[model samples]
Target: MAIFRKPGRSGQPKPTPEPTPGQVAEELAELVEELEEPTAGGPADGGPSRQVVEYEAEYRAERGRRRGATLVASIAKLIGAGSRSAAKGAAYGGRAMADQLMQAAPRIPVRNLATLRAQHPTAADADRLAALLITGASRASAALGAGVGAAAMLPVPPAMAVEIAAETLAVAAVEIKLIAELHEVYGVRAQGNVTQRASAYVAAWANRRGIDPTLLVKPAGLAAMALGAEVRQQVRKRLTRSTLRRLPSLIPLMVGAGIGATVNRRDTRKVGRQVRDDLRSRRPAAAAYWSAAAPALPGETAP
Candidate 1:
């Protein structure tokens, strides 16, 4: 696939060149302008420490405003982008999506866990950082969903499913980044080189849990090995199911933007909460450790 290739130079997964952090900063600036607001999340570099206390509030409030726009503006956005997308899309096939995930896995940005801790220096720092990444991912998926949702509304041949598949790959990048970074915050590192770690995190994201250490035990030349059909199959199944779950966004009714936005938001939040809980279950003292650092997260108000 275009995004991944065979390992280079005697057998190490050649690290994907990092997209300039400036690119992320610029895109985020535009997103904030388009929505007239803010949100937060993990680094594009894949570390778990970030400052997201403020953006979460804005995203939580965006649903109601988008609900009001569902009848006109949101629909307008979807249809307008269809023609351009149609030119690039192909006939959607199951294998197409599976291939996309395989390609996307290695591109997920993940920072070294030890480095992430050294940079932040506290357990609570990780939680606050994970919050930003989690919320940032939620917003990123919603934006992709909106565009795909829009493309689907147009009577553009088989382009709708094709567009959906493309955006599925994009959202997978965002979520995979979140999942891998979350592992750092919980102090459980997925073992391996670049592509190997991405594969393990892809499985965790699809399986919707903390990284299974057992999956990380591959030895010697295994780091450069391609992911087996079993891993690819699980990712394919998860992506297809997640895409189908967004169908409610197609309803031209009151639920329009609200449904997709709400579902994506709630679901990502659930993934964050669940994974954190599961990891904490393994290290019951994690929360207590962070709790001692700060009673509440920055910008996390009294509830």
Candidate 2:
């Protein structure tokens, strides 16, 4: 398919350049913003508040449907490439996926305490906001999983791979954003440049725990430097496990839909609860949250 190729001077296909980190960050930020924000009328309008998170999830799923053909073509090309690289061993795919995830981790847009309070003025305390965030994220993750599973019914079975990949990244983005925001709510916000703090959250996501205050101050923490080999390996293993867990959702027909949604919701809630519990224990006194947590300024990022 033409979608799988780009013409070159000699009529050979050429690869497209990867997006810059800035571009990826912008894209992810926009996506999360859409998912997190309330409906146009807001809660004050007294409109039909059909689950806002579910509505947003369906929006993304609709977009995925429109791109279904492209997804199939892209996966076709990916599978072909995989066949050619079989000699390199199975670890290659895991490693490459991990690298893409790591590249993405540092770019997730995280709001600080100031932004959270401003956006959610009605929430009087950190715990209140944290509860809302966890519930919304869990529902969103379930919706995304259901959407992907439903897509499996399409004639293009191979496209399940692409669907799974997209779902993984999207769900990860949602959860990582949740973890970062929870930290903000609890007043244990990680200290660093945009990339550094984000990297710490990524580590937290992989580890299935909140950021350790001691680690953030330590020179050996993942936040102290760019993602190292060991950290990347940890991420790879975590992602590998995550991807495998979604494999059952590839079953044809609508059976996968129920399976996918259930698994995703359960996993997301588990992570949220784990991180929330950790943060609750470590959070500083309520009075210190505002003074200690700095606002995340516009266009802030690591060099």
Candidate 3:
């Protein structure tokens, strides 16, 4: 017992000391100081600071405005192109109809009736009377179609779709009636006689336009012709005198195409606006929720 073990060598480990309460308090104070330091460009909490949020809001608003402007401009250009096409189509259709009428007019005996009235008094009186009736009916039908087509081509709002449809139908009716009346007045009373004449007329017009004659004989073809005539007339009325005089020969076709193009454009824009509004109205609430949940301070938990 009196012989104590020799002390450990210098390589032995030393005893550890416990930390004091004062040291613990000092460490806590250092941590608090670090937490209290202001963030570089944000609030102390992790949430976006007021200034940062405001700036972001402004940026987003500006970006939205630019995008909106671009979208509107694109729509306008498309609408303009459509309007031009419709006008042109109508004009061409009218010209075709007119050409057909002019060619057919010579075949009728009325051309000689005018001269006979001053010379032979009663030369081919029955034929002259029949021809007059036929010519009158044809002219009336052509005029009616031209007027309605023109009205449809005007830049009315989309709300007038019903009116436009009515006008288009009216024009087609006039055209069909005119053909029937011409046959009746000319004493072409055979079964399917009017239909045959109509087919021949359509074929002649198609040949002039370089389209399929079969297309011109279809019901759709007649409708198209009437609509086209209307469109052409409208374009002619709208153009400046200088342009009208310069392009007198091509006016009908140009106007019809322009009207069709215009209608397409206007309708497209109307649909686009509706879609934009719907999307804007349907924005998710999640955006607002996330924007509201930002942390108030860098070291604080999100509220």
Candidate 4:
């Protein structure tokens, strides 16, 4: 049977396409960068910058719309009024997530020692800056978790899968950035090109420690500088565990929101402390000996 065509209104703008994984990573990186720098003329209290608080509100609002739409469709499905396409779309895998993370890692910007010093001139010691970076990253991560958790009450199972992937990628990006910056703070910047250094940081993220240049396993030949296969496998395992840990945050009612935020904040702080301790142990002595010069801090200009 032939159906009649309906007339459409003119001058309506097209809706924006859903962002790809890479784009999301870039967005998160930009946000982290903004959060890193101290705001001009702001208070000296050392809390999250104005941007961080604003982003949390914006992030929650955006996620609310996405999840709300999905929840309605999900409810329809539970009532036998929707299709199974959503379940299929939610079949995202851990390997794919890891690959996306590896690709996105290099895109995240890490400031050098000179830049960090310039940006934070008041910071008298590496530990001071490290503490600020850790706090900012922790707040950002908590915001992400809370945004996803508060998205819906009794989130649909299929929708929860997608949310888990989004949260995992976002939280990972924030944590990876934290790890890289901590390396900068302690003067242990990884060697190699941008991609190579990022891969090293990703490895550190997987191991939950600072990058030890000597212990790094480089590939052979032309690809020798790239992230090795063994490390990729480790990243996959790490991401899977992280994803699983987020499962409890999908509990019915609004309880999940609090759990997600607290867990993310605590986990990020824990990682920051662990990496800091390792870097501190490997850090060179600041005092100069009579016969020799003390090594300069990472990114510090050598005398």
Could you tell which candidate, 2 or 3, scores higher by TM-score? 2
lDDT string for model 4 (1-303, tens) is 012444447655444344444555555655555555544442345666778766765665455334333432332232222245346535666787788788878887676665665666677787887887887787667667666667547756666676677677778878998999888777666766778888888888999998765733342221342447888888889888888887777766767777777888899999999999898887442332111222446887544
State every prediction's TM-score relative to the real structure: 0.60, 0.70, 0.21, 0.71
Sequence-dependent TM-score of model 3:
0.21
Runs in model 3 deviating more than 4 A are 1-127, 142-154, 159-164, 185-187, 192-303
Off by over 4 Å in 1: 1-91, 113-125, 150-157, 217-226, 252-255, 283-303
Model 3 C-alpha lDDT versus the unseen true structure: 0.32
RMSD of 3: 38.4
Look at candidate 3 and tell me the lDDT of residue 285: 25
Backbone clash pairs for candidate 2 read none
lDDT of 2 by residue, 139-252 (tens): 667766776677678533544565576566657777888999898788777776677777788888888998867866554565544557767787778877887888777676
Q: Backbone clash tally for model 1? A: 7
| Candidate 4 positional error at 295, Å | 19
Q: Tens digit of lDDT per residue, candidate 3, span 139-250?
A: 3222322332333334433322322232222222222232332222232211323334444333322222212334433556544543455434532332222122222112
- lDDT by candidate, in order shown: 0.56, 0.67, 0.32, 0.67
Candidate 4 runs further than 4 Å off: 1-13, 17-23, 33-85, 215-227, 284-303
- Highest TM-score against the true fold, candidate: 4
Worst 10 residues of 2 by lDDT: 67-76
Q: Which stretches of candidate 2 lie over 4 Å from their true place?
A: 1-31, 35-92, 154-156, 218-220, 223-225, 290-303
